[model samples]
Target chain A: MKILVDTLGADKGYEEIVKGALKALENHNNLYLTFIGNEEEIKKLVKNNTDKINYIDTNEYIKNDEEPALAIRRNKKSSLHLGLKALNEKEYDGLISCGSTGALLAGATLITKRLQNISRAALTIVFPTEKNPCVLLDAGANMDCPPELLVQFALMGSVYSKGVLNTNNPKVGLLSVGTEEGKGDKLRKDTYELLKNSDLNFQGNVEARDLLSGNSDVIITDGFSGNVLLKSTEGTAITIMGRLKKGILGSFKAKIGALLLKDVLKDVKNMLDYNEYGAAPLLGVKKAVFKAHGSSNARAIETGIDAMVKFVENDIINKIEKELAKKEIEE
Target chain B: MKILVDTLGADKGYEEIVKGALKALENHNNLYLTFIGNEEEIKKLVKNNTDKINYIDTNEYIKNDEEPALAIRRNKKSSLHLGLKALNEKEYDGLISCGSTGALLAGATLITKRLQNISRAALTIVFPTEKNPCVLLDAGANMDCPPELLVQFALMGSVYSKGVLNTNNPKVGLLSVGTEEGKGDKLRKDTYELLKNSDLNFQGNVEARDLLSGNSDVIITDGFSGNVLLKSTEGTAITIMGRLKKGILGSFKAKIGALLLKDVLKDVKNMLDYNEYGAAPLLGVKKAVFKAHGSSNARAIETGIDAMVKFVENDIINKIEKELAKKEIEE
Candidate 1:
């Protein structure tokens, strides 16, 4: 399968993206990548895999601070815009970017377009839970989601969970203040009614505290709350880890313990590491689009590529289209 | 100072609340507590401290699932209602409840009432960060906050941070999706414009990821997002600790490390412990009202009482009222 890789907008430089792409190419002989941005640097990084790699050199790139829609419309020669355009034209099976999330979503929506019957595409994140890696979405895509948009997110999240994450039935839960039917704000109350009546395996509301407990395979929320949940979780993890490090280094006895427990600590850190989880898929778009974290390193990029390949192989976009179509007919 | 302690609505039984109250009485000689719960049970537990304790015997209480406004209005004889009423009438200096947050907020607003010039009261939580204990407000109170309400929350939070948490010139930040001025949804954008114009040492928009980093002394958001941030942070911390425990127990070598590092780990846990932090004050209320965690133990209750006493002594409500009145006059 061929993928268009946007090598800009990452907090880390293009070299890291290129290195990750090279590693992905090494792992899968059938995988082909088209690197966009700073052509000279990407070419130098992928010198060994020139046969399987393509390059679109451009120093212009959409910045994280740029307005997404305006940036996409204005910066036509930028790597993100160029990559999305190529993906839209069917030059690649999918697109991967460690760029601005807003810009990627905008370009994907306006350029690649949404699937038939899908009003909004969701930015979906897959994170590790105690029981399994669960799916959470619209993780900052549509901030002000109406009830209908939330319903669409729930349906799309369910499809991604089943098709790519390999969850059976994929119980969907609405993120709310409480687990009751009418627990959250107006949007949640209305969406709860809709989800309860849907054909999917709809679970009742799941509170934020139960997010990592794996109570449901697909946890759906509006982008605003979902984004807050995602970042708060990340922030808390960093804080705890920082505290642990400071505590371990504070005393002589603790230093000895830390030496002995180094492996265990590594294991715990790895479990919470976003690098292992790789990319978040922009689901409901006509073509497959995955967004890696902005601070992604080489390893995260490799994992992102692997996730993108799985998303393509599973035909998630087509499956989502079919599910929505089926629901429309049933209605 | 005199305080009314509502002994119902805690997930833990009234016995725990009684035990906590007893501990608080032992710690403060000049302090008085009115226990509002099962009269006979409270009497049995506080028999040793009867001199400092007053009993209002009533088993009636509001449940967590009950609608906040309706529950307060209907359950007039409930412990929460009686306590709020007594506090409202100036029979007590403050009120402490380990009861339903919604019921407490609603009762406090309706019965105890908001401070003059304050439009809404905020549910305020003081949590530990890397630098100091920062105050987060509207932590599930006003779910649908307009820009003006958020400005109110910022002011109230700043007051609590300075008066209770003892942070000087508290930096108030509006929680949003990004740190940029216009990064978040409509509410955030509008709130940003107002806060920027206000004289509350307004820090720009704070991302949820920077919440625990001590970037701001006061973090303000609408109740929905604030609740999500609060619970998600708790969930993530719990998940990490669980993983660390599991990892340590999985190997004998790590078990030895855990044994050696027990004290350090205990210290870390203690720092994050809600029991140490005591209770969250319901800011903007006319009378001092504090809400202890639903799972409060004896220690948490003791600390909560200490916090309540400090809040009353500091005269946070009067300070907030004056601040709001000044702002109104200036406008």
Candidate 2:
């Protein structure tokens, strides 16, 4: 399978991206990649992995501070824009980028376009929950979503959960302040009504406090709130871990205890780490598009590539299209 | 100081509430309390400490499932309603309730009335953070707030932080999905402008991830998002601690390590516990009102009463009123 990789805009630089791409290529002998970035630097980094790799020579990229839509529109030769263009026109099965999320999302939507009957595409992530990894969307793709858009997110998240995450009959829950019906703001209340009417396994409303309890297989929220949820979870984990480290070092006995429990703590850390989970899929697009975290290390990139390959293999695009079409017909 | 305690609607039952109130009364010899619940039961609970205590005999109370506004308006004799009414009419210094948050907020707003120039009341919580305990407003009060209301929240939050929490010139922040200026939904964008123009120490937008980092002294958001942030942090902490406990119990060596680090873990748990933090103050109301968590045990209720005493001692309600009035005059 051919995949396009935008080897720029990541915080760690392109060398790490090249290393990760090479590792993915080594693991999947059948995988071919087209790298879009500074050609000379990437070539020097890639060394002998030239057979299955192609290059689009351009150092142009979108900065994090630039307006996303305007940057994509103006910077035609930028790695993110070119990668999306290639993914749309070429035979590549998917595209991966560790770029500015806004630019990548904007380029993907404008260049690759949305799937038929899909109102807006959503950024879907598999977050680690107490019971299992649960699917959450729109993780900062569409900021101001109407109730109808949330309904679409629920449908797409359900498809992604079942088709890619391998959850059978995933339970979809709307994120709200309270778990009871008519508990949240207007968006949540309206979305609750639509979700209850849909064919999906609607689990009513799920409070934010129940987010990590693994109460629902698929959770849907507006991009703004979803982003808040994802980031809050990340920040809280970091703060707690930092405090624990401080506590462990402050006392001699605790230091000894920490040394003995090092392996167990490492396992817990790994379970909560975003690197192990790979990239978040930008669902509802006509083509497969994955966004790796900007600070992703080489290992994270390799895992992200693996996740993208799964997306391609599962034919999530076609499945999403079919699902949306069926829903339209039902309506 | 006279305080009104609504000994009903708590998940742990009135016995816990009575026990907590009695404990508070014992600690503060100058403090007097009026209990609003089942008269006979409360009198029996407060048998020896009857000197500084009074009773309003009534078994009527608001249930968790009842609509908050409706219940408060219809059930005049309910503990929550009676307490709020007494707080509004009598010489009570403050009122504390472990009741439905909606009912408490509605009754507080309608009966006690909002401070002059205050458009709406807010539920404010003092949450533990990395640096210090920071104040967050509109925790679950007004879910659908306009830009103006959020501005009021920021003002009230700043006053409460400086007056009660003792943060010197508290840094006020508007909560959003991103920390950058103009990086969130319409409410955030509009609120950003208002906060910028206001006299309060307006730090720009703060991302939810930074909520626990203590980047700002006072964080303000619409109730919906604030609740999501609060609950998400709580949920993530619970999930992590649960996993750590399971990890500790899974191996003999880990268990030994945990025994050594028992005090350290307990300290961490206490730091993150809501019970230790006390009840959330409902700001902007004419009188001091506090909402303890529904699941609060005796310890939490004692802490809640202690916090309410501080609120009254600091005269936060009048301070908030002055701040709002000053802002209005400046405008």
**DockQ score of candidate 1?**
0.75
For candidate 1 chain A, the 10 contiguous residues with the lowest summed lDDT are: A40-49
Candidate 1 Cα misplacement greater than 4 A, ranges: A47-49, B47-49
Write candidate 1's Cα lDDT for B139-218 as tens digits: 88877788899898889888888888888899998898988888888999889999999999998999899888887999
lDDT of each: 0.87, 0.88
Model 1, range A125-166, lDDT digits (tens) per residue?
A: 998888889999989988788898888888898888888778
What ranges in model 2 sit over 4 Å off?
A47-49, B47-49
lDDT for each residue of candidate 2 in B27-54, tens digit (9 for 90 to 100):
7878999988888887777667677888
Task: Return the TM-score for candidate 1, rounded to 2 decimals.
Answer: 0.96
